[model samples]
Target: MLGIKVELIDKIGMHSSDTAMIFLEDVKVPASHIIGEEGMGFTYQMLQFQEERLWAGAAAVVPFYKIIRDTAEYCGQRKAFGQPVLSNQSVYFRLAELATEVELLRSLLHKATAQYCMGHNVTKMASMVKLKAGRLAREIPDACLQYWGGMGFTSDVLVSRFYRDFRILSIGGGADEVMLSIIAKEMNILPSKKK
Candidate 1:
């Protein structure tokens, strides 16, 4: 495990300002808590972000897979017009397609994280993973909810909990827009762009 933990020092919109500060403050440690070299802290922190973001991206695939599978099961078990809802090709195929997308995104995130660990240029890869992960964070639950119809909206459903939990990925670690800015900066397309 890495020897660092990042806490957001700013929160606007949803949560309270004090909540953000509380996260920022965390708990102070003794001076001995420092590890390795003092000057290397930024580098270590950046690397930690890479690993953390990659894990956050890759982790989405499992619950996404389960959501699609369980939605399929629900559709299959529920009867419509004396036949199962899964009988409809549109519904089942779309669920399968989303599953395939989750797999592809997982692969991309893993490969990018590997490149990052190797000390290669990985800003584009990282941004791509972050962007895709955020999109999937929204897409997976929305799709699952659609499949469940009214039942998905209720708090009792397992899918509802996933819907709420996965939402933090985009804005929590770093907003999707923030990742885009990082990618743009790395690509020399922002202020650094030739004018």
Candidate 2:
């Protein structure tokens, strides 16, 4: 621990957050500090990741709903041409579609949570929720931001902040690809490895 060094890496978005690369040199961790069994660290970490992905999926639902609701409100007040932007069929319809998607994700999250509470394995469901959450986090903001027009592109607005922050949902808590792989394995659809 004495020789360990941490360096921060500047990222394109999430400017308000911290991302650091830690370099461990001659680091020795005591047996007491090890989580769970000595040789079971990877298993423990995977179990922890299941909880993390579930939490990430559940947490994303509210913000997505808020973004859509807020954007809809903004559109109602902000006029384009001779009428409010929300009055346009395309705008309202798109909002409806996004809202439905958000609701679906929310339902999936709840189902997974209930299963987990009943002491059942939620691995497959959690992976699905994580995948959906990540996709929605990307899709919802992008769609809503369009109605914000120029303001959404600027850094001053909340929508812009959401646009930046939500991008990490797909990459963090197990990436979309990783989640897909997990789901595929759970479904027994992945091709078996050749020895």
Candidate 3:
């Protein structure tokens, strides 16, 4: 704890969950405090990231579903052109698509969890889940916010809050590019490096 300085980073998203930049200035950590064996930190962290990816993917399912429902409800009550905005073919159809996408992600997350519980390695499955979840986190909110119209841009609405919050899914656990690389490596499609 000594020589450690913590500063909260002011981020556009994830306001409730505070993110910080930690500075370690010549901190002395006892060997007993070290996690696992010496020189295995990288291995340990990599192993932890698999679980993190799965969690980030699975956790997003219900929240986005709620967002979709709420946005739909709002649109149904709100009128445009003398009819409910949701009555438009474009609005409801897109909402259906977003809902369906979340369902698919939920299925994938459940399958990955089952395999994980059975003591199977799920790096590929987790990566897939994470990648899809990250994309949807972006897509679903953006679409829903558009339906919210000017209100979506404001901080008052839940859609706006989620827009800020969930944007981290793609960048937090692993960037989309990193997830793709992991999937590619697992698929045997990534080119081998020249030795």
Give lDDT tens digits, candidate 3, residues 85-139: 9999999999999999999999999999899989999999999999999999999
Clashes of 3: 0
List runs of model 3 lying over 4 Å from the truth.
Answer: none
- lDDT string for model 1 (1-195, tens) is 244445566542234334422223346566799797878988888777766777778778788888889999999988788998889999889888889889989889879978987888776787778788888888988888887888998877778877877887887667899888888888788775566
Query: Cα lDDT for residue 35, model 3?
Result: 80
TM-score of each: 0.76, 0.93, 0.95
Candidate 2, residues 1-195: lDDT per residue as tens digits? 487999999887888889999999888889888867778877888888878888988888889889999999999999989899999999999999999998999898889999998999999999998899989888988999999999899987787888888888899878999999999999999889999
In order, candidate lDDTs are: 0.79, 0.89, 0.93
* Pairs with backbone N, CA or C atoms under 3 Å apart (clashes), candidate 3: none
Candidate 1 colliding pairs, count: 0
Q: How well does candidate 3 match the true structure in TM-score terms?
A: 0.95
Q: Which stretches of candidate 1 lie over 4 Å from their true place?
A: 1-20, 23-30, 34-44, 191-195
Prediction-by-prediction clash tally: 0, 0, 0
Output the TM-score of candidate 1: 0.76
Candidates sorted by lDDT, best first: 3, 2, 1
